[model samples]
Target: MEGKNSQLQQRKDDALPRGTGNLCQWYVDQAENATLRDVEGNSWIDFAGGIAVLNTGHRHPRIVQAITDQLAKFTHTAFQVTPYESYVALAERINKRVPIAGKAKTAFFTTGAEAVENAVKVARAATRRHGIITFGNAFHGRTFMTMAMTGKVAPYKRDFGPMPASVFHARYPNGVTGISTDDALASLHDIFTQDIAPQDVAAIVLEPVQGEGGFHIAPPDFLQRLRALADQHGILLIADEVQSGFARTGKLFAMEHFAVKPDLITMAKSLAGGMPLSAVSGRAEIMDAPGPGGLGGTYAGNPLSIAAAHAVLDVIDEEQLCERALQLGAQLTELLHSARTTYAAITDVRALGSMVAVEFADAQTATQLQQQAMQRGLLLLTCGPQGNVIRFLYPLTIPDAQFRQALDILGSLLNQPRS
Candidate 1:
């Protein structure tokens, strides 16, 4: 008989579409905290954290209990069709935490893409403008408007166009590529002079830390300038914290690190501790720009997700995951920095709290490191347009001993002779 792993792989090949990229070959049998077990009985340490969706760890009891409790009562009522208190309660919870000033409101959606799209929709309605701005190498989402807003070309926006109009891109400062903040700001000015004028712009959307753009941390002055420019012109500033929010950055929200505030914020991924939930919380006036029956989905803020989100917030407070993220990030950043001496190929290691990444010389070097990391039983993921950056999104709930073990394994791979 064929081995169970092989059998499952064959079935997966026959059943699923190739478009749904499977990074790991084996299916997970069970997971708890940072440990994952495959159906074939092999154990692996999780470092990807389900693409930054499990900051509280996989299957936290609080979340499970909350989800279970809500399941027994009811699953979906389509909040717009028959509103629920859980949705309002969760919004209130987020309202108190968002970095926005003054009164704020929140709207829920099912995925990060929906939150992004809705944010832009509200921005357009509020500003009554057709133009939006984004940054090169930044990732918003995969939907039509977001895809247009995204700056990457291949894989994400390759034949999907003709993309939506009035979505412009400014250069995001990347030290690795020698782009300075001055260069980035100059590019924005160029966009105004060369493309859409600033008056026609509705909002400028960016990831506080560019998640899919290789874990680039936005500089404080960059954000401040954006805020000032948004005020100078009549535009909204949107912080896409979908992958970097909810204590991932050693803070409740990564934008909290910056001195400036965004008019709107879109969050998801870890917002519900792995539950499928996304939300847009912003200024009350802007969030209310869309008229009644304008901004909701059939399963938006499903009761189960709302309940799980409430438990997630409670767990974040009880477990102090924000402090844990800082502790973990310091350790990982130090290891990555030290490993640079062992491996000359590593160009840089950077982190903002637990959102850490190490960049290699090229895509092949990074890909080799990823495969070798797996051989050592540590799951890793690559990011960036060149795919030369290895991002570490290990759950903050990972045990110290286990996390150190994973780090050592990675150091061994990085120390290997250049491929």
Candidate 2:
């Protein structure tokens, strides 16, 4: 008598570890553009965007065709074993596009964590230092080194044995949370004075726009200060654009918004339009510090992923998704700000382009809104260290009519009395 979704849920619960959490109970039967259909025929407007991995939307035709073309030719040859033109070509394209100064070099990987880890490797190789400094509420990755670099502890680090050493945390500026730019910088200096000396630190990695910690846009002045500090200390500045890249932030890269540039940048989500591909681009000299074979994987630049990445770049340019991101984000931000008047539970609404989020007065309120929106056939995701911020990661390619419908559902939910 169980429905297909219920049956699948039961099977999943039995087969998978609880650590691999599921936000929706229903199983997806199909997905396209900005909508997902469950096995029961219910369609949900997707706002999670597969956690910012679908800036170009699900199963985009161009990306699909590119993947199909590669599938017909080859899947994997291990770039390190047998070099491929697509991998080199993709790196060249990225090298030209990255915001780093002086010729940049890019290397591909399989995931955000891999890109981040390799960035650190390159930084250490170049600077001859082993220490890494990240910030509070930063979610770099689930790997041991990244886990240590990550600032939050509850779920990401919980039950995971001791993290690799030489990683420290500093405060990230949050005006809403009362941590200012000065305070964040002070925390960094405290780490230098109290924990690791500046000369010993290889890199200071941070998200230009913190994703899971809540969509807090790093203030421009703060970034400038960090650049100055990094320069003064001979430490590399790494912008983890894993969640903020690929036109999601009204620009191809969030670093484009600031005048200061990073020595290296880590990217993954939305890089290959849902294909598992990550990359780190940085100054050529720093990237080359790692000897050959020191920075590649068996599946680093799978031909299929490379093909998809090419198509993704093409689609972003052809569709003007960067400009579209700005337009859509502006509309959503205006809506949330307008809703603030009626919803007392809405404490803050913030955004950097379409990477938007709304913080409620309490975690319960945020979760309630997410549940209510899901019930209305709209998928939403909640984040923040306290679980009080609901982030919107809707694809930039979402049709206007569908997007407007999702907004209406959210408006109605917000206008209602808090339960």
Candidate 3:
């Protein structure tokens, strides 16, 4: 059966258009903890963690059991037609847990892109404005509007032309580039003064930690000032936590580090232990601005996905994964830093919790490092505008021994002289 599947995959790739990229070998048989096995019987320690979707590790027993229990009871009810308790209970739990101060409400969706899109819809409905502001190097999604919001061009926005309008990009405060919080604010002011008026802007959408554009941590002061500015202009502040939420960043949500209260928060990736689930949670008043019938889909909150999400939350709390993330992150960061002394090519080493990264001097070097690591039975992902950053999203549930082994392998590789 495995042989047949391999042949089928090869045939599919040959027959279909190759616009979408493929990763790793052709066949993946099984995965557990922080390792994946290809059909060829090679095992590779997974550092990418499905781009931060396996914070609790691959196929966590609790999450699996939850899915099994829900599978036995009936899968889809189309929430609008027949609501389920799991969905309501999960929503209630998220409402109570998301790091907002006052009353908050949540709406579930199928993907991170959907969550982001819905957040914008809710913001526009609440503020009755037509413009949205985002940061340069931001990657929201692939949809028309999100592509317009995204700042990167080569791959994501290259062939996709005539994107939605009224979405403007601002410079994020990047200390490495000498752009300060005040500079970011000034960029916003320039946007309002030279481009779009503040009164016409509905919301300012930003990632607490920029994911695809490189692991750039947004300064706390920048987020605070954006919050204040949004309030002053009666505009919504949307925190896109799709990549940094669910304990991937020590806290339940990355915005917690800044103590900024955004009007909307979009989350996904690790929310449901690998299930296709996402959510837009925020201020009750603003979320309620959208008409009752305006916010729903056929598979918005699948019962099976909701059950898995509940178990995910339970595991996070019960296992104290957030604390574990912090410790593991520190260990990895130290290891990377120690190796950097030998590898002068490593320019930056940064992380929050287990969401860590090391940027190389250029895309060629980063790609070479990734290939070298994969050849050594470790899988790593390269992300950044220039593809120079190697980000680590190992599962929080990875065994200490396995993590240490992976770290040793990485150190050995990075310590090698540039070829």
Candidate 4:
């Protein structure tokens, strides 16, 4: 059966289009902590951390055990039909820890896109507005509405045709490319003046630290200003922490770095310690705006995922992985900085906790670096609008020895002359 499955995957690839974007040449046979063994029996350190979904590392013992225990009792009981304590308990825990000031509530979903969609529903329902403002280079999701909200076009939005209306894009504050907080605010003002009135907007959804948009960190001032603008215009402020949540940015949520409070926050990625779960937590008044029947899904808060989420939360708190993120981030930034001196093609080195990134001269160079690293048994991911950025998302629970080994491999790869 295993051989048949492998053959099926090989055949499937031949039938699949190149547009789908293939990462590795072989299948992942097993993974533990921050290491993955390919079908060929070669192991590679997982610096990508499953795109920030393995904060507790792959197959974390607690999460695995929790899922196993839940399987013994029951697996699915659709919360809306036969409510479960795990779902309610997980939601309550998230509500209490979401970094909000006032009363907060949480709703669960299966993916980050669903959480974002629900957040939009809550905002539009509460404000009775039609328009939403997202930033340039933003990546919300692949769903029809989120695709409309996303600012980038190329592979994600091309040919999708006539996206949802009333969604506008403003410049995000990026110091490297010269976009400033003032510039971002100016764009927002322009949107109100030219695109839609402030009162007509339902929400301004943003990433505290953008994921697919080259790992740009939204300046504290910019976030504070946006918060004030939302308050002034009665627009809901939604922080999409799908990638930056669960200690990815050395905080429970990236918004904790700033004083601003968002009316809604969408989180997924590492929320379940590698299980499939996403959530929307926000001001109770705003979240409750949707009718009781207007929210939820059959597989939204699956029992197994909920159990894993509870274990993930407990592991994070008990292990103090947040502090570990800071320590690891600093170490990685320092190492990358040293390597930059030797690699002229390497330009920028920036990090927020373990969410670090390095930009090359161009996409071709980034691709070459990634290929070369993979040859040497290291795995990495490329980001940025131009695909010139290499983002590191190593799990916080990765042992120092393995983490350092991955860094050594990366350092050697960076020192090699670019083609």
The top-ranked prediction according to lDDT is 2
List the candidate 4 regions with Cα displacement exceeding 4 Å. Answer: 1-9, 14-19, 416-419
Task: Sort the candidates on TM-score, descending order.
Answer: 2, 1, 3, 4
* Per-residue accuracy of model 3 over 1-419 as CA lDDT, tens digit each: 55745786788789978776766654678999898998777899999899889999999999999999999999998998999888889999999988776999999999988899999999999989989999998989888888888889978889866888899999998765688999999999999999999999999999989999888999888888888898899989999999999999999999888878888999989999899999999999989999978898989988888999999999999999999999999999998888777888888888988779898888999998899889898999989888899999999999999999999889888887663
Per-residue CA lDDT of candidate 1, range 1-419, in tens?
78788898889889988777788888899999899999988988999999999999999999999999999999988998889898998899899989999999999999999999999999999999989999999988888988998889878899775998899999998999999889999998999999989999999999989998999998888888888988999989999999999899999999999888899999999999888999999999999999998899998998998999999899999999999999999988888887777788899887999999999999999998898888788999999889999999998989889998998898777666553
TM-score of each: 0.98, 0.99, 0.97, 0.96
| 1-419 per-residue lDDT for model 2 (tens digits) | 88999999999999999999988999999999999999999999999999999999999999999999999998999999999899999999999999999999999999999999999999999999999999999999999989999989989999989899999999999978899999999999999999999999999999999999999999999999999999998999999999999999999999999999999999998999999999999999999998888999999988999999999999999999999999999999999999888888888999989999999989988898899999999999999999999999999999999999999999898876552
Query: After best superposition, candidate 1 residue 98: deviation in angstroms?
Result: 0.6
Model 3 / residue 321 / CA error / Å: 0.5
Question: Model 3: which residue pairs collide?
Answer: none
Worst 10 residues of 2 by lDDT: 410-419
State which candidate, 1 or 2, has the greater TM-score: 2
Candidate that scores best on TM-score: 2
Candidate 2 has a TM-score of 0.99
Candidate 3 C-alpha error for residue 140, in Å:
1.1
Q: Name the 10 consecutive residues with the lowest summed lDDT in model 3.
A: 19-28
